[model samples]
Target: MSSIPIRIPTASIYEELASARTTPKTVTSIHEEDGSILDYTERSSDGPSMPPHGLSNQALPMDKLSRAQLIAEQYIKDNKLLKAHEELIRCVALSKIIHGDGHWRLAKAFADLAYSYLTVRGLPVQAKQHAESAKNILLRGVDMSKSVEEKREVLGTLVTIYYTLGMSHLLQNNGRESYVSLQKVQKLIADLEELQEKTSVLGKISDKDIALALGRSCVLQEKLSLAMNFFEQAVKMVISSEGDSSAVLIGIYREMARAEQMKGRHEQAIHYLLQAHSICQAVYKKLSEKAAHTGLLLAKAYAAAGRSEYNENTNKYFTESLSVYQIVLGADDPQTQNTRVEFSKWLIQIGKTQEAYKMLQEAVGSETEYSETVAEMLSIMGSIHLADGKIQKGYQLLKKCLEIQTAVYGSQHSKSKETQNLLTALQKSGASWE
Candidate 1:
């Protein structure tokens, strides 16, 4: 049997998450390897911070399969996804030779290949094809199995394949299909638990993985509260496993913050955002693009948090995050421009119309293919102009913004309606365009 420890799903897990208070985990500055989240500190960590958890069928010898899987994983970490895909293909061929066709081991190889295609290579079509192949192979294995335990083991492998399929759908923006696939996986897990009578369903599937995937599906479904519960449970699982919290908890924290933000729980959102920032800072490269992305997320969260309670830290976070985005993403990048727009809007909110106007001017001058962002810049600038007593200038700018919005989103779009209403109000205020 493979020595890989797998997490099994159970009803108590969901029950606990549903009933527990949602609290951001306390983060410290030290790398306490005991699985606690650490402060955001740049480190010289070797290899990828998040490596794949080795999983395969128990029937295969662990050493050879593990070796190939590790090599493929390293390729993925190095961003050589094509190489990773090739390596997995080789592993799949080897598995077919050693474990024969229709074996669960071969099914696992196919599943891994599908994951590489879906996530690394961004080939959803190929990913779905391979996921189905894996599922069909695993189903055949389960049908031929004689013992209940054997059937359960094959089902566990299917759960992983189903997850890959869900990811494939998600990658293609088929959220409803993704949710359906995830639900099927959950049902399979439930069946396995029932058969085992609450015994650990820990085969090749982790409850944390399932929970996180389910959380993502719920997010697609707009069930923010349920999503947060699942994300919290996933975080708890990471801590309990003595795993590196930085690797696992960062994404969970970010998603949890998003859910809180959607629910208008700005304080809670900021808490989770801080936790995500802290974790990303702990292990992520200081000047890496990943750090910049995380900073951007924190910036938006800080801005939202400030909307409810304007604090110095909100400004501090925005300043630091904007600096990082500017340096790493460059002045012309859409995200950097977006960050500038956000900062300018914040400045306007705090009665800094002149500064906001200058900022928006700089942002609007930048060339971008994103007309939506351009429209946003123009609107903010118009608002700043209005606040600064330039009624005619604000009127022209608002009318221009409305035109851009209507062109991009059509006249009947909600965004266009908003701009139209704003322009009408400005006109009613005697702001005339000559």
Candidate 2:
């Protein structure tokens, strides 16, 4: 994540706003790693000529704010995210002291702090709170701006705030709200571009980011056409800016494949998956985990393409994926085991129950922990045994599946209940095992 610099142009409008309020609306506190709490409240009028609790040894508030901003930038560059987050908190407190609560500068500080929470700490809830606070302040301050520089600064801060807010909403699975927030960001960026008469706006938030986010939001809302359109726009933009061979295209192609599948355009979906698989083969090593994963996706896509004639392609990719996964990721890795389970299920679908059973036995032998994957494997194995009239073995496997499901998903979960019902039916049918 890039650091957004706080630039405050000299203006009497801001000066008047800064002096209109002495105290900020809320008190901010910082918790240190050593279990120390630093209160960043405003100093009383009659207090000594020193700073706040943790900043007593620092310079004046303005100078300290500048230093804190610089330190935060350095911390981010050094990948010290936790320390950078702390410094951003200090910047918020110092901005309140220097620019008051209602000034655009303070809003910019909040926007930066909000972005840090989202990008650096992956805390979307905190990001949304600070982004909303910034928006509130900016809404009140935007009308007072007169100069071009001030307008540019305000618009830049707004872009960051809306982008952060949109991503926060998306993370929380509020698709409609996320689309609304991202639309605001897109409009703000367009306005900024028009104001400058330039192709590039002055922020880290790009058109591609907006397009991809809008696409994801649309996908969540089941707006498949709009989602595909946005994804296509993003694809064109990325290809125009970065070359065709850029690694970013791999994910976009996979997303496009998913959208096509959702729309029941199986051939189109296969085309996109082929593109993604090709990219994976070229960008990563031939036998890399990424290549293996892409092969797995391609195999599943072929199997789901509603054409039994594509069984050859499906089997080829499945074997390639399994081989690479067993070599690169260990045979006991969750992903490898899951891939085995998926392939075994496909085998059973093609009427190769004995082959599927052997694969399931290998997976079960290596599984050391009780997980959803293990439970699924056991269930399938039990069903295979029951179909072969091995009642005693089937009963034992299903009983273990029931125990695992209850332990992992609780006894009241649908999976556990289903397994319980199956066991009951088996007993009621007079199937005896000793």
Candidate 3:
């Protein structure tokens, strides 16, 4: 029996896919207001169209598809995410033209495009839409898959679709939906593992990635113990794949620290934070923002531990954090100012009000704008002065704080009302402000 020859679709199909109003819309539509696709394709009106390798209309759709996929991968490797996103959009259109809308191949194309939207463009809503579309197509394709290889391929695509959907839900803060979708991903990965199939669908995602995401969703749902379990699982996976000194462990350690802190295991939290801080100091520049942030977390953990022995450690980390922030982010940067404010608050808590007041004074003096940070510093400075029996200075600072609160929060806001009440009480205390 002679098998029928498969005829490839002509360039006319590519033209229709390119020009038809009914074709899958590019993901750039999600950010059309920002003009992200300045020169995306032949349909782009803003600038000269960038056909794949300057291919003409006569180019075969399959050829264009292969080129688009290759270019997209290259763009991703080069960290040109926007360009990659554009090529992925082209691949989606070309895939539909080559393999009809319901084919598993098309579903795989949509899944790839969805993942690109999520990771490359940071557009979760678009990612969710494309992933759902892929899921619908895959559901039909899975039943039609005949060979074991075809079934495995469909399952791989399903895994990617579900994973993208899960992450998109997580990014949108829908914890329950995120957990459900991620659970499906976990089951699918297990199935693939049982089949002795390498998970090619998990290009950048791994068992550790799924575990970490599950832990985060569990954290959002307030399931502390379960979250810690998943976090520890992630830590173990990372340690097994990459040694303990791997920089990836820093984020996992921080997440574990947060979970411990939430569970009121302060010592455990401090232990995790110390590990993360040490990793940051070794992997990143000591004065880098990453190291400074880790130091800040460690300092906060020490302060929250509420032990006298940890006070020196707390102060040391706080000072280091603030100095690093000042040196790296500049003194006028909001992060630097925030670190200074946090350090001052910690100082006041430890009965170092004079030092706290001086730090706040320097911060306030450098301010060019009346921001919420300035208002907070002023309020704290006023309270410090009042506690020290410097009524005149306290009154002046309180008045300035009140003015800023009124301007920032409006006269009827709770903060403004509170400041107004404080000023009124000061006046009743016989403080003349003529």
Candidate 4:
């Protein structure tokens, strides 16, 4: 729990430095950066006070708290979780010491500490504990404050803490708890809105975010219609701002597509995906990972809906998606290889057997891992070989695919059984394209 202490540079230090400009006759010394403070003597020309008891003293060093926060932020940016945890813990301890346990600043420090544990360290239990502590402190501070602005600040931190708790619960698959926490966030946002103040602490957070969170929670609970309503609200909130906030609009569109797909409305899903793709094109104005991914989603919706144009969009998206995946995730990455296999399946569906065969061959040649990607590629290659009039080669590849499927899915699985039946039929018919 102990951390190395860093020296604080108080706001008074800046004032002192500024005062040095007018008092050039007096000695002005700069402190060395070796963690020491420079002492300054006062030169008040207004003469010595009669009592001197009411004179203000030099300001305390408070910048160390800000410095500690900055250090923790950089540690998080660098993915140094342990260091971030240590620095935030130090900040929290120092804040409690300086501001006492009930101050809103201490509550904020506790919230930051909880975030470090939750996001950086992935320690949900500790994160929840810290969040609870922060919430308690903020509640106490809110009760003690008379001003609405002061109470709002505490309430904002409280909302964020609940949001963190909700996300943590969601990640742990505690759907009911996540929903409850997020519901609290919604309630707090509504309360803040009723204040009719322009400086509402919830300014950065819109109803759209609350709706999206609720929608995702509803999705987890299998309430498709309810989820769709929330997605609709989120979409409505940002639709007018699409030109300025295409990124947000794109995400909402994708979520809407997901809800539509779950409801077996593939055409509607495709509509949302196309809207997302249009935003990606207009906002980015160039080839980007977002555009490529949106293209893939559109292709998927097309395929799912049994559209005749599936192959056209599939081929276009697969080409761009594969290229971007290679550039962003590396050529040999399992994800890139898996994407190639997925693309091959579409190619084979459209009678482009040679192209599919070439793509699978590259995947099989480089990928040594025994994954579903490899097995799928083998199965696709088998079909390609059969199309090319190579029965023996196709049968051999089919057997390999069956073996992998049996190993991965077990012999009793539908996938293994299907592959087994295919091989059996191939043998019985002695099929040959020639």
Candidate 5:
């Protein structure tokens, strides 16, 4: 492949910027218009909390939003996305307001903020909107009034914004647009590479950017083999860019494992996931959310390995997934319980009905779990128990299940009627919900 030429930022430039950025950012305490600290939103384990990084809060007439953004940046450093979103939005809004609406600088802020949301919020739609805003602003032509450094900043923002747009398109199932944006990314990477080749000092930054673009592109293309290679490259670049000290290496390693899994290369996936798991465990103690998530991914890789390796180990991985999920989300969180319950079914299939029964009990009693989702949990439990000769116990659980169904959707709810019929049949067989 013909490597692109790109110039890396001068060491002096980074040193100066680092010094400037080191100054503790001033945060406006309040938004005059709403008394809501110029931040975007407040805490809600349920809804949007704060805007993440890359937002401009300068538009709010006050620095409150900037303050919020600062707060969000710290939270992001701590890996608290919800809190970061709250502050990042404030930061972007304030940046935009201060810089004037839709100004390139402000657009850059929006683009960065959107990037955080796409990765952390699990909300791609909103992320796409913000990235587009950035691209649109840069499209208006660079403001010549700005210095070279300023113009370069805008160009950099455009690169990231386009990357975000490409990923968002993939998530939205818009393959065509995704491909277009990816091509643009590739062109940008090539251009950056060329510049850095000529100016070797810029190599690190340019390589980091190129690796990110290539890794994402490969993953979206379903080229898992290539994706793994690019992701490894990205990890190396990330390490170099951040220096040997990194608090986030485990995450990238996990992502690398995911790419390998997509290729159905279980052995490699397990290797990377195990490395991720080890890093997460040592770096993070106390069953940290980060560790739990890494464990979850590792478990999935192990489970997918099926009997190709150790059957006992595979079961252990599923159990570990359930355990980690329970610690983070509690027993009732639908996603957590669902995982445990599903694993339980698989256990039953392997003649572990006794273990499955315990998981079922947890699923039934969990308030945090969605009770009305009988289509999977309840029905499956009912069938499993009945087949295993626990008819009476199954009938009772199934009755409670029906009552829950009827309570939310009325007795006429199709699922409810179906369960009711099952109960009726059970009665004829001399069985009881009690």
Candidate 6:
């Protein structure tokens, strides 16, 4: 996760926001070593780092029968998503014909297919459709399983698929929604605990993995204290047996940073981010990117804590982050384009308004999926307009931003609040921003 830098509202604007707090509002993924969503939406080098699963069925029935399945899996492995998707649908149909509905094999095939779309094509709706299809099969299998072990095993797969759907939402930047999907995990955990009354071992495994996944989701929601407890419990499980999980350690550090930052301990936040960064650097380059991204935000947090004191340090970190995004993601990557806009906003604040404008123009030109980014460009330009005493132009630019957000997310979104607050500020100051 990255830091969202917010400008402080003027007193009158703050008053307006306070008054409007009760007014209506509305509208709404990751990989880590050994799990998904430990940290999501960061710079990456174009291929999934998650490992492929090996099919366990050695039955001749599935071998000759799963010929198309084999070819589909290979296509995904080779990064051919469209072809893989086409083949997988065919496989799903054949599996239904041969194994009938809701078979374990059928569910696994659907899960495999959904993952390919979610991770590779970045299509959340398509991913969600297949995941639900897969979940239905898993559910049916759970209901039919006669043995305790069979039921427990199927439950685990169900938990992972639900978690993957949550990832799809996360990748689309809908954190609130991702939380909703994860509610399914809580139900799954409850089911397993009930099962544990009859079988202890399966119960322990289910409890641990669910807690770990839940804690990570809490981290995304900025529930730091809860996340801290979750990670601590998770640590108890790992250090006791798993040993030296740097990825897990990285999460612990991140949660600490968030906790410290929320508590206004900027220096401490920076320290935790640095420690996290160091851990990733030493672990492997794949992990270092997480650290690097946090390091950039660490500096931002520090700047926010003491805006007047560390202006130069803030600029340094911003420049470093820009360099990292450029090198790691290329300028055209959606994440990089967003970062470019973020960097430009900081530039505008430091009196480099023209430079900020130029970068934003370039960003708007780039190919990317995040339209919310356009808000940043317009917001910065509006601020620049206000600074130049061109109140109407600034107000209009910001207004345009609000319009786009409203059209896309509707009137009650968290996004529209930014616009509302800005308009209120303008109304008070006798500026034309409204």
TM-score of each: 0.62, 0.85, 0.84, 0.65, 0.62, 0.53
The residue-by-residue lDDT of candidate 6 on 295-359, one tens digit each, is: 57755775667576777777776677666766777766656667677667667666788888888
Off by over 4 Å in 4: 1-87, 98-105, 116-129, 136-142, 194-200, 203-206, 240-245, 309-311, 323-333, 347-355, 366-372, 379-434
Model 6 lDDT-worst window of ten: 23-32
Q: Which is the better candidate, 1 or 6, if ranked by TM-score?
A: 1
Best by TM-score: 2
TM-score of 5: 0.62
lDDT of 4 by residue, 12-32 (tens): 444454454355333323343
Which residue pairs collide in model 3, if any? none
**lDDT (CA) per prediction:** 0.69, 0.81, 0.81, 0.70, 0.63, 0.62
Give the range of the ten consecutive residues with the poorest summed lDDT in model 5.
1-10
Candidate ordering by TM-score (highest first):
2, 3, 4, 1, 5, 6
**Model 1 Cα shift for residue 249 (angstroms):** 1.2
Clashes of 6: 3
User: How much lDDT does candidate 2 score?
Assistant: 0.81
Task: Name the regions of candidate 6 deviating beyond 4 angstroms.
Answer: 1-64, 69-87, 102-104, 137-153, 165-212, 219-222, 232-268, 279-292, 307-309, 323-434
| Tens-digit lDDT string for candidate 3 (89-164) | 7777788878887888889888888887788767788789889989998776456447777767877888888889
Candidate 4 whole-model C-alpha lDDT, 0 to 1: 0.70
Per-residue lDDT tens digits for candidate 5, residues 142-260, read 67465655645655676678777877887786755775786676676666555452243232235554455556566767766766676777778767767434655666677677787
Worst 10 residues of 4 by lDDT: 48-57
lDDT of 4 at 271: 90
* Candidate 6 TM-score, true structure as reference: 0.53
